[model samples]
Structures are given as C-alpha cells and as structure tokens.
Target: MKLYYTPGACSLAVHIALCEAGLPFTLAKVDLATHTLAEAENGSTDFYAVSPRGYVPMLQLDDGSRHTEAASLLQYVADLAPAAALLPPAGTVARLEAVGWLTLVSTELHKVFSPWLWHKETAESTREACKAKVALRFAELDRHLATRDYLAGDRFGVADAYGFAIVNWATILRMPLNPYPALQAYLSRVAARPRVREALVAEGLARD
Candidate 1:
C-alpha cells in the first residue's frame, strides 16, 4: 500500500499504525499548504486528482483500492494485521471500546485542535474558547489515563496512536499539558514505542 500523508498531521496516527502492524507501505507527502504531493511517490503531485476531498491519510492498497479518513484508516490497517493485535478481535465489546476511543479522539480532540489553533487569522476569542474546551476534554483523558497505560485495556492500540497524534498538539499549540500529568506521561510512553519512534523519524518529526 501507499499512504499519502502530511507530516505530523493526524495522518501520523495511520503511519504509526502501519509500522506497528508490520505492514509494508510507501508514503507520498502531501503539502497541505499547496495541496500537492511532494516527491511524487505515487506518480502524481496533483493531490486533488488523488483525493477530491483533498486531505491527507489516503491509503492506496495494492489492488488499486483506496481508504480515507484517519479513524477508518487506522482501523483498516489494524484489521489487515490481526496478529499484531492493533485492534481486538472483530465484533467483540473490546473491539467496540477501542473503536469508540478512536472516534472520540477524532471528534473530541483532533477536530478541536485543527483550524482554530492552526490558523493565525482565527480570532483570539475563538482560540481561547477552543483552548478552554480542549482543556476540559484533556482533563477527561487525564483521569482515564491515570490508572491505565493505554486507552483500551493495557496494550497500545489504534486509539493510543490516534490519541498521541492529537494530544501531542498541546505542545505545539502552547496549550498547557502541565495540568494533565497522566496525559503528559501517556505521550512519553507512546513516543517511546519502537515502531512509533520509527514513524516519527520517517516523517522527520524526530531524529533517527
């Protein structure tokens, strides 16, 4: 498969998931600023032609099929490698629980951080309100993480990968993570994973 992504975007979650699943794939870098794919790994730089929706995290399978959306892509990659245990067995409550965490992270966290925090033209008042809401959500995550090593059960899963991608935004957004020590520690633990570290370096987010 070939994954189209923007460095450090939510697509990072899918990238980490792929690595964790031991799936072999290539990456096509999407320059969101230009909506162009850099290095043209997939043969076309016109990201618009690749994805009409024009977002990163578009996974092109070997059979010429494509998958979009971060949460869905995360789950898809996990399902492809059941032995990796990136997700629990299908149709089980545990599986739903992990998937629910992915949805929550996507809606509750990822959506909150984007647009408002990412754009300079966003009104200061709007950014402040966004920050307040995110803090409340962070507190919820902090409480849950206090006694748990991962979002679902005790093993690193898709939700943890998705959560790390979104929650790590706190540092770049200058939002205070100091209030959420458990969440803060959670970030460290996720970052320390071998596969996660590999993804980070591949995307130039960290040193090799």
Candidate 2:
C-alpha cells in the first residue's frame, strides 16, 4: 500500500493508524503548495489522477484500488488489521460510537481549522467564527475526556488517532490549550505512543 500525505495534515491520522496496525506501506509526500507529489520518478504533479478532488491521505492498495478521506481511511486500516484492535468490531454499538467520534473530529473539528489556518484569504469574521466554533468543540471534548483515557473508551483506537491529529492543530495555530487541561493531556498521551511518534518523525513533524 502507498499512503499519500502532507505532513501534519489530517492524513497524519491515517499514517498513525497504519503504524498502530503494524501494516507495511510506503509514503508519498504531497506538496500542497504545488498540489503535486514530491520526488515522483516520473516527475508528475497530476495528483488529481489519484484523487479526483486532489486531496491528501489517498491510500493506494496492493490491488491498485484507491481510497480517500481520512475518516474512511482510518476505518479501512483498522479493518485490515483487526488483530491490532485499532477500532471496535463491526456491527456493534461500540463501533457506531467510534464512528460518531470520528465524524465529529472530521466535520466539527477538522473542517473548522482548515479554512482559518490554511487559507490566507479567509475573511476576518470567518476566521473568528471558526475559532469560536473550535473552542466550543474543544470544551465539549475536554469534558468528555475529563474522566476517560480515549475518545471511544479506555482503549486507544482510531477515534483517538483522528482526534489527536485535529486537536494538535491548536499547537500549530498557536492557540492556547491551557483552558482544556484534559484535552491537552489527551494530546500529550497520544503523542507519546511509539507508533504515533514514529509516524511523526517519518513525516518530519518531529525530531528523531
């Protein structure tokens, strides 16, 4: 499998999931600035060929099929390594709950950060609104994580991986996390994982 990614983007979650699952995969770095794959043998920048929308975290499977979207990719990696228990088993309430958390992280948290942080042309009002919404989501997550170790439950699953990737945006945006100690602690916990650290270092987001 080959996982196309942009360092520290939402694709970080998928990278972390693959590592946690102990799956063998190659990394293809995407230069978001140029919307091209860096160091391609053919020197092709036509990332749209792999993903219609030209997004990161596009997983090319061994059979040459492709999968996109961070949330779906997370579950796909989990399903591929069921023995690793990266996610709850299929057809169970726990699994649904895990999906719920993943959805929240994607739609509610991840989307909120992208516009304000990535797009310089965003209106000031829109940026402020996005920050406000992010704060509300963080507050809710802080409360939920107050007594729990992970998003889905006591286990460190895919939901936690996704959440960590989104919430870590606070650091990059220079947004204060002091108000949400639990959330801050949650980030610290996930960052300390060996597999997560490996993914971070591989992506050049962290020191080796």
Candidate 3:
C-alpha cells in the first residue's frame, strides 16, 4: 500500500494507525500548496488524479484500489490488523462508540480549525466563532478524558489517534491548551507512543 499525505495533516492519524497495525506501506508526500505529489522518480503528479477533491490521506492498495477520508482510512487500517486491536470489532456498540468519537473529532474539531488556518482572509467574527466552538468541544473532551485514558474505552485505539491528530493543531494554531488539561495530557500520551512517534518522524513532524 502507498499512502499519499501532507505532513501534520489529519493523514497523520492514518499513518499512525498503519504503524500501530504493523503494516508495511510506503509514503508519498503531497505538496498541498502545489496540489502535486513529489515523486523521487516521476518528479510530480497531479494529486487530483488520486482524488477528485484533491485532499491528502488517499490510500492506494496493492490492487490499485484507493480509499479516501481520514476516518474511513483509520477504520480500514485498523480492521486490516484485528489482532492489533487498533479498533473494536465491527457491528458492536463499542465500535459505534469509536466511530462516534471519530465523527466528533473530524466534524467538530478538524473542520473548525481548517478554515481559520487555511483562509487568510477569514472574517474576524468567523475566526472568533470557530475558536469558541473549538473551546466548547475541547471542554467536553476534557471532561470525558478526565476519567478515561482513551476516547472509546480504557485502552488506546483508533479514536484516540484521530483525536490526537486534530487536538495537536491547537499548538500550531496558537490556541491555548491550558484550559483543557486532560485533553492536553491525552495528546502527550498519544504522541509518546512508539508507533505514533515513528509516524511523526516519517512525516517530518518530529526528529529521530
């Protein structure tokens, strides 16, 4: 499998998932600023050729089949290695709970951050609104995480990977994480995982 991704993007969640699953895969760096893939042999390829939406986190399987969307990719990679227990078994309430956390992180946290960070001309009011919404979500997460080590359950799993990816943005966006100590601690715990650390270094987000 080959995963096309932009460094520090939500694609990092999938990358961490792959590593945690102990899967063999190659990384293809996508220059989102140019909407091109930087290939060592081919120079560059139009990213749209992989996905019409021109987004990162496009996973191309060995058979030439492709999967998009960070949440879906997270589940796919986790399901690929059930023994890893990256996610709970499918068709169970526990699995749905994990999906619910992914959805919240993607929709509530990730979407709120994207516009403010990507759009330089975003209205001040809109930026403030986004910050307020993010704070509300963070507060909720903080309350939940105060008792649990992970989002889906007591063990680290796919939902925690997705949450960590989005919440890590708070530091880059200059958003204060001081108010959500539990959430902040959760991010630190996820970052400290050996597989996640490997994924971070592979994406050039970390050293060694």
Winner by lDDT = 1
What is the per-residue lDDT of model 2 for residues 1-208, given as tens digits with 9 covering 90 to 100? Answer: 9999999989999999999999999999998777887765455666775577788888999998988899999999999999999888889999999999999999999988986766889998898999999999999999999999999989999988899988988888889999999999999999999999999999999999
- Minimum summed lDDT over a 10-residue window in model 3 is located at 40-49
Ranking by lDDT: 1, 2, 3
Candidate 1 on 1-208: residue-level lDDT in tens?
Answer: 9999999999999999999999999988999999987876367778898899999889999998887999989989999999999999999999989999999999988998887899999999999998998999999999999999999979999999999999988888777899999999999999999999999999999999
Lowest summed lDDT window (length 10), candidate 2: 40-49
lDDT of 2: 0.91
| lDDT value, residue 185 of candidate 3 | 86
TM for every model, in the order presented, reads 0.96, 0.96, 0.95
Regions of candidate 3 where Cα sits further than 4 Å from its true position: 40-44
lDDT, candidate 3, residue 142? 95
Question: What C-alpha lDDT do the candidate models reach, one value each?
Answer: 0.92, 0.91, 0.89
Residues 1-208, candidate 3, lDDT per residue (tens digit)? 9999999999998999999999999999999988887875344488876678898889999998988999889989999999999888889999889889989998998899986766879998899999999999999999999999999878888888889988988888888999999988888888999999999999889999
- Full candidate order by TM-score, most accurate first: 2, 1, 3
Query: Model 1: clashing residue pairs?
Result: none
What TM-score does prediction 2 earn?
A: 0.96
Model 1 — TM-score against the truth? 0.96
